[model samples]
Target: MVASTGHEPCELGPIDYLVIELPQGTTTLTEQMTDQIIRSVSDRTLRILELLIVERDGAGDLTVTEFEELTDRGLRGLDASLVEILAGEDVHNLASAIAPGRCAVVIVWEYLTATSFTAAVRASGATLVAQGRIPAQAIAATLRGDDEDA
Candidate 1:
């Protein structure tokens, strides 16, 4: 199910991408969806940060800016919510308060999706089926809390 964007071809791998078209004058959930996705991704990112702090030696004392620089790989399209959360006072202060000898370290995994991709499509008020790279088996495993290789 390939839905043409009428632009360059988007290679979505094997996952089925649904391009839902919103009807004329249809109510959009773009803001709501963006909020939800941002929150979820931010929370996950925070968790990863916490884990990194725990794993690295003397990593509890880095500044927020330092952490941002270190983890700046895949945050290209993060929405404002995520940026705010990352730059919040608490996070900044925490990074700054690390022990004198310790440096803050954060390990980030690859983010597979963009913050605005789904929201913008939803806002466009259109529905169409498109092909993606997300494997159905992987999605099922995720839903079941099983390993993807299982």
Candidate 2:
């Protein structure tokens, strides 16, 4: 769901999506977290494609809110493309991951650091074979000598 950012050459990095659950009873992002995000976007580490809030009620019903309308979220300058990259099924799965009566923020971002490398690889006619991410928990478990997950 990468939309044009109206930038020339359009050499984009890897796109990534994340879901961060808000602590129960809290909807506002912490100042420290906000600062880090601002720094990352400002320094071109990432480009935001979409940002939305999902809330699951006690009855397990789901509701979504666009980040722009949530002025209290403290992400004023940061703008999302609001392209709705996540399909309905994906949103459903994300909602299922949230505990009842809680909320979470869904972020879709492009990794700017790999842009030039990807462009160079393409220029050399190299094709991407495959890509994947290893969960941090798996690394932690392996380091702790937990063979079950290893």
Predicted model with the maximum TM-score: 2
Clashes of each: 20, 0
Regions more than 4 Å wrong, model 1? 1-62, 66-71, 83-93, 105-150
RMSD (Cα, Å) of model 1: 17.9
Q: Could you tell me the TM-score of candidate 2?
A: 0.85
lDDT of 2 by residue, 1-150 (tens): 123657745667888888888998977566786788778888989877777788999999988887767765557767643456788788878778889999888888888899889888878888778888889999999999998986
> Residue 138: error of model 1 in Å?
32
Cα lDDT listed for each candidate: 0.38, 0.78
**25-124 in candidate 1: lDDT tens per residue?**
3323234543553465576432122212311124443333332332433443443222122334544444443444443433232233542454456557
How much does candidate 1 score in TM-score? 0.21
Looking at candidate 1, what is the lDDT of residue 69?
37
Name the lDDT of candidate 1.
Answer: 0.38
